[model samples]
Target: MRDYLFPTEIERLIAAAKKSPRHGVRNNLMILLAYRHGLRISELVDLRLSDIDLQSGRINCRRLKGSTHNIHPLEGDELRLIKRWLRVNSNPHSEFIFVSERGTPITRQSAWRIFKDAGEKAGLEVNVRPHMLKHSCGYYLADKGCDTRLIQEYLGHKNIQNTVRYTQTNAKRFEGLWR
Candidate 1:
């Protein structure tokens, strides 16, 4: 599948989301979580109240792709966003990390729609999906010089080869050097 929003596009989407009255907070938080955590929509939707440990900056992801559980570290902007989201939305009775206005856990389809709508509102011309955010996380991490083995594990890819695809250096970056 085509990779989702580019870095610039993601920024624009977040900016647009910040202006939305109804979903501004939730949408922006979702964007931050997706890009920073490399989480699939299913994984994101499945997040429960107990999965996050803000004090420790860790997130526990359960039943990831192949019915496996993993614990991932959160840092930088991702951790901050999660903390903010929790402060704004958390309730004693709710178990899901993200909830709809009706107080139901966010569905995967809803998550996809939120990202797509946010991208359109931002005037982004590319297709945006929740998985694209996951791809962006992997791509950005690889670009920042993260080791492939680590990136592979973080993304929960069972095969190293699939993770390698995320690390494909942008050919355009080297085009100038060839001249």
Candidate 2:
């Protein structure tokens, strides 16, 4: 079964990630963007400096699972988080936005570790992983009553079937079912 965090859990995860002093800035940036943009761990790790445009507020996500690359909007607190990390991070010259302590791009395994660490700190029952953040993004958007096709495009899903699960999983949609 696919895993997804509720909106509250998402917030809790963010808080837990933020509470960590070690690599907190970078971890927050990575987790926040993964949720905001529905990015796969590979995409998150592979993102380059040129992929984001702060002025235009756009993220050019390179879809990895047989989907076409697409440009997505960037705004709100997510943008601010990116800016804050960039301002304080020592590796201003690194190609990748999410870098390791050594100033090199973090591997997918390291990205997974970041999410796992946050899950432990957040006291979540489910083991959090990078893809769960992406699923949270999908569920969050779906809960907001976003169109399925739009979510499909936003997520860079080549098949609508893959995106259909979000619609089925939107817990808010079933509110008052028996009432």
Candidate 3:
């Protein structure tokens, strides 16, 4: 099976969102967080305001497939962007972070639309799906010399086999081998 990875498209999506009247900071933040934290579509839509700790810059992402949870921290520009996004979009009493204009948590279809529209605007030829963000995160970490065990933990994958693909795809790991 092919892994739909797009670390670069993720950046392009953020850039394109800034130019869009509709995409706004919230949409950009959602896309960034999806890649940074390896979140599934359901996890992204299911986030609640209370699950975030602004002072600590931590997000308690719900690992949907395994019925577990993992804590991921925001760093650098992501932390700043999260603060800005919350300032504009958060309803203090709302049950979820990302919501429709009706103030309800966005459905899976809406999440799908968010990525698809942004990908198109970014000039990406591939059909964008939210899961690609997760794959990008995994591949990114692997390519950056992060351990497979850590990637598995960060992604909340219960099986190591699921995480092994990233190790296989990291070409840099083979660099300097003939030296």
Candidate 4:
């Protein structure tokens, strides 16, 4: 009944997305960025090329639902993937980073379908909805011992309460209680 994907599951999804017959690079980058940056479907689909600063290895995350917007540093892998996608992009003129075959910005529905299909292709046990990527990012950061406040800001949560749940279920927090 877990809603978030483990790191291994995320890796599997990325691999599965890469195997797609069309737009494989685009699809995988979508998943990777969504998970890495804790982006909601709307946010992911709304991303623009101008939001990323390749020279600085950073991205301006435009959060929704009144959350605070922040710049997130892109990992080397993410940067490489993004560069690869850009080189193979169907339409270089499109404002959005991710685009459909027609060079239109990818819709939220299309992004959802891409994640779901990648999940199925990865043989994931849980139904992979786009939001799960966001949740997975939160949990991953929590499990890694990242400060709750930092995780909150990273996920763009206006309230710390929203971020606590990720840490609440982390068994590692109680690992030494009996000792």
TM-score each candidate.
0.85, 0.91, 0.91, 0.96
Estimate every model's Cα lDDT from 0 to 1.
0.79, 0.88, 0.82, 0.95
Where model 1 places Cα greater than 4 Å from the true spot, the runs are 90-92, 170-179
Query: In terms of lDDT, which candidate is strongest?
Result: 4
**2 versus 3: better lDDT goes to:** 2
Per-residue lDDT over 1-179 for candidate 1, one digit per residue giving the tens place of the 0 to 100 score: 46866788879989887777877777888887777778888888888869888888888866465733678888767777766777777353689988987778889899899888888899987878788888888888777778788888887777788788766774533446757
Q: Candidate 3: where is the Cα deviation over 4 Å?
A: 176-179
lDDT of 3: 0.82
Per-residue error for 121 in candidate 4, Å, reads 0.7
User: Which residue pairs clash within candidate 3?
Assistant: none
Q: For model 4, which pairs clash?
A: none
Ranking of models by TM-score: 4, 2, 3, 1
Evaluation by TM-score, superior candidate among 1 and 2: 2
Report the poorest 10 consecutive residues by lDDT, candidate 2.
Answer: 168-177
Q: Between 1 and 4, whose TM-score is larger?
A: 4
| Ten-residue stretch with the least lDDT total in model 3 | 1-10
Model 1: how far is 111 from its true place, Å?
Answer: 1.1
